[model samples]
Target: MNLYNLNPKYRILVTGGAGFIGSNLCESLLANGNTVVCLDNFATGKKSNVTPFLSNKKFTLIDGDIRNLSDCHKACEKVDYVLHQAALGSVPRSMNDPITSNDVNVTGFLNMLVAARDAKVKRFVYAASSSTYGDSKNMPKIEDVIGKPLSPYAITKYVNELYADVFSKTYGLETIGLRYFNVFGRRQDPAGAYAAVIPKFVMQLMNHESPHVNGDGSFSRDFTYIDNVIQMNIKSLVTNNTLAVNTVYNVAYGKRTSLNELLDLLKEYLTEFDLKIGSVKTTYGPIRKGDVPHSLASIEKAKELVGYNPEYNIREGLREAVQWYWNNLK
Candidate 1:
C-alpha cells in the first residue's frame, strides 16, 4: 500500500522527526514529494536518523524542543499538517521519573496542540499509546473502552487525548489520535534501558547472549510494524470522513504474539544471517511492575474509518527489521 500516492502532498511538520518512527514518516513524505520540516531536541532522538535527509531540498531540520512554546510555534510556521510524534516514551522510564515524563509528554503535548491550533493546520495527528488501555482485560481492545492508567507514561498519553479532545471542541482544531501498540522496526533504538523487546532481543541474540523474557514468556502484545503505523498516520492525515475526525483509532496489526513466540520468530529470521543466533538461549525473569499480561487491538475502527489495511504482519516485519540490524547495526 503506497499511502503517499493516495493523497495530495503538502508541507508537513514532523515533531521528533529524528526518532525511529518520525524519521520513517519524514522519509515517506519526502519521497511522495512533500516538503518536510523536522523539529527535534535530540533528547531521545538521534542525529543519524535525520542526517540522510539533510541534503534533500524539501527537507528542513529545526533544532528545537517541543516543551518550549516558542519552539513549537517556530516549527509550526506555515505547516499544512502536524504529525506530533514528540513524547517521552516507556513505562519503566516514566515510573522512574514521573515529573520529567509529565513535563515532556503532557506539557509538551499541550504546547504542540496550542501551536498547531494557532497555526491553523488542516489536522493534528498525535501518537497515542496502547498503554492507555491500562488494566482493561479485554482480549481485543477497543477505543471507547479503557481502564485506569497503570503508569505515568500511560497517564501522560491519556492526558494527551483529553487535551486534544478539548482543543478540538473548544478551539475548533481538527485532531486525530492513533493509539499505537508495541511499535517496532528498523532504527528502533535497542541501546537504552527502555529499549523495546524486539530490537533488544535481536541485539542480544546477534551477540550470542541470552535474551531475557519477563515472566513465563506468555505475556503478549499487538506488536505493530513501523510501516503499518506510517500507513495509519498518512490515513489519519488524509481521511475526510467526518466521523473519523477528532477521534482515536488503534494502530496495530490486529494480532497478538507471545514473548516466547516473538523470540522464536526473531531467531528464525536472524539465523538466516548467522546460524549461531538460532542456538542462543533465553533467560526468564519476574514480570515487571505496571506490565500487562496481554494486549491486542481491534483495528476494525481504523479499517472502517481510515482505510487502514496492514500489509506486514509479525513475521514479515521481523524479517526486514532483523536484516536491517544485521546490515547496519551488526
Candidate 2:
C-alpha cells in the first residue's frame, strides 16, 4: 500500500464539480477536511448536484465555463491541485454534434490546462476516457498501446492526453490523466437521450419498460464504480511519487461484464422490489459504430504506482446504484 504525503492546508479546484463524478469528488474532499473550489457551467451538470456542499464552509462554488480562459483562470487562483472532469461525453452524442463536443471537450480542456499552468497549480489531473483505446483489440488495455480514435468524443479525450503531455514537456506543467472506463453510479442522469447504460437501464426498469440492448448483448465493458473513481482523484491530487507524476492511469475494476449478463443481473436485483418484474424481454438493435466488442483495463500500473485498488465489481456497484435510484429517483 502506498501512502501519500498530503498537505493538510491544501485548497483544490475541481472543474465540472457539479456533475456525477465531480460532485462525488467534491463531497469526498470536503469530508477529508480539504478546502474545495468547484467550477461548473452546468452545461451537462445540474445545480442540485452541488447543493449539499453549499453548507460546507470548506466548499466554494464557481459558476463558470471552461471554454472561457478567464473563467478557468479565476477558478485556478490559489488552488493547489485541479481535477478536470468537464467534458461532453458519449460517442453517439458526439457523432451527432461533433463540433460542439470538440468545443467543450477539446478546446475547453486546453483552456483549463493553460489556466492551471499559469496559476502554477501543483498538478493538473484531468479525465481521459477508455474511448481513447478505440479499435485496439488488446484485452486488458495497456496505456502504452492504443489505436486510432473512432469518434469525435474519443478524439477529444485522446487530444486531452496529447495536450497534457505536450504541456508537461513544453511549459513544465505537472499533469496526470485518468482513462475512465464505463464509470457509473449515483447522480448519473438517466433522463437524457445520451444517458449512460446503467442509469438508463435502472430508470427503464423503474418505468417497467423493456431495456434495449444494442447488438447481441454480448458486448462487454469494464464498468467502474463511482467510489473507486473518487479514490483515484484523491490519490492523484496528493501523490508525491516522482515516478507517478506526468502519466496516465486506468481507473477501472479490471474486470469485464457482458450486456446480456448485465440485463439479467438488473432484472434479478429489481425483482426484489417488484416480483412481478420477471425476465425482461430485451430488444436487440444493431451494433453502434465506434463501440468495441469488449473493454477491460490492465490496472497493474495504477496499483503499483498510486496504490489504486478497486473495491467494487459490477454486481456490487450496480446493486448499490440500483438501490439509490429506487429510493431517490423512483
Candidate 3:
C-alpha cells in the first residue's frame, strides 16, 4: 500500500553523502523514491563510495565544500530535508589539527545550519556523536546528563546539538540529532590513520599484522550497525511527535561490547576465510587522551518517543561487516 511513502517530488540534501554513513543514508533515501542531492568535499570521503549510484535518475551529486557558505547554500536549494553529516570525525585527528577540525565541524556545521534555516527545509537531521558523554562515569548515558568534552572533536559534535537547539528556538527550524555510538558496517573505510576500530582491526588481522589494543582491552563501546543508523534517520525525518522536534536521541543497540570481546569476535568470523591464518595477537598500548574509559547508552527515550528499535547486536553486526570486508577488500 506504500504506507511509508513520502512525496516523490520531495528532494533531500545529504551533506557528506560520499562518506560512509552519509552514502548509506543517500542510498536508502533513493531506494524509497526520494530525489537525493549529495554534497561532498572529498576530504575524508571517497568518490568510489558514491560511484555506484551515479546513474540513478533521482540522485544528484555536487562536489563541494561545506566550509564554504556558497556550497552549503547551493546544495540546500529546493531540498525538503537536510541530513548534515559532513565533519572532521576522529579524536586523534582533531588533536593533531584542532583548528581545521573546528573549522569544519564547528564553523562548517554553523554554515549548514544557517543554510538549512534559510532554505526552510521540512527537517534537519544531523549526525551527533556519543563522544559528547566525555568523562562522565554513567553506565547507561541519558541524554540529559553530560560532562565536559574531552577532545576537540567531542566539542565540535556537542556544539552541533547546541546550534541545533538555538536554530529551533530562533528560526523555528525542525532539527533532530542522532548521537551515534561507534557505528560500523560495509563500505566503512579501513585504510587510513583515523580508521575506526572495527574496520582497522579486521584489516590488520586479514593481513596478519598485530592489532593494537589500547588500555588493556577493557574499554567498551555500544557499537551500532549502519542499518540501525539508517532506521533512526528515517524515523527522525518523518515522525509526527512534537516532542521529537528539536530533540536528541541516543542511537545505539544499548549493549556494551568490550574491545577484547570485539577482537575475538572478528578473529572468529574472519578465520572461515583462511583457517591456517596466524593467531590474532594484539599488543596493549597506553590509554589515549580524550578517550572515555567506558560508554553505554540508555536508549529508552528514543524507544519511547520515536519507536526506535535497534535490530543488530555486536556479533550480528560484526558478522555482516566482516563478510563484507572479506568479499570486497580482501
lDDT of 2 by residue, 95-183 (tens): 99999999999999999999999999989999999999999989889999999899999999999999999999999999999999999
At residue 179, what lDDT does model 2 achieve? 99
Please identify model 1 stretches exceeding 4 Å from their true place. Answer: 1-9
Clashes of 3: 0
Worst 10 residues of 2 by lDDT: 1-10
Which candidate should be chosen as best, given lDDT against the real structure?
Answer: 1
List, residue by residue over 7-35, the lDDT tens digit for candidate 1.
Answer: 43588999999999999999899888789
Give the TM-score comparing model 2 with the true structure, all chains together: 0.97
For model 3, the run of ten residues with the poorest summed lDDT: 1-10
Residue lDDT tens for model 3, 82-111: 988998899999999999999999999999
Clashes of each: 0, 0, 0
RMSD of each: 1.1, 1.8, 1.3
TM-score of each: 0.98, 0.97, 0.97
Instruction: State the number of backbone clashes in model 1.
Output: 0
Question: Candidate 3 regions off by >4 Å?
Answer: 1-8
Query: TM-score winner among the candidates?
Result: 1
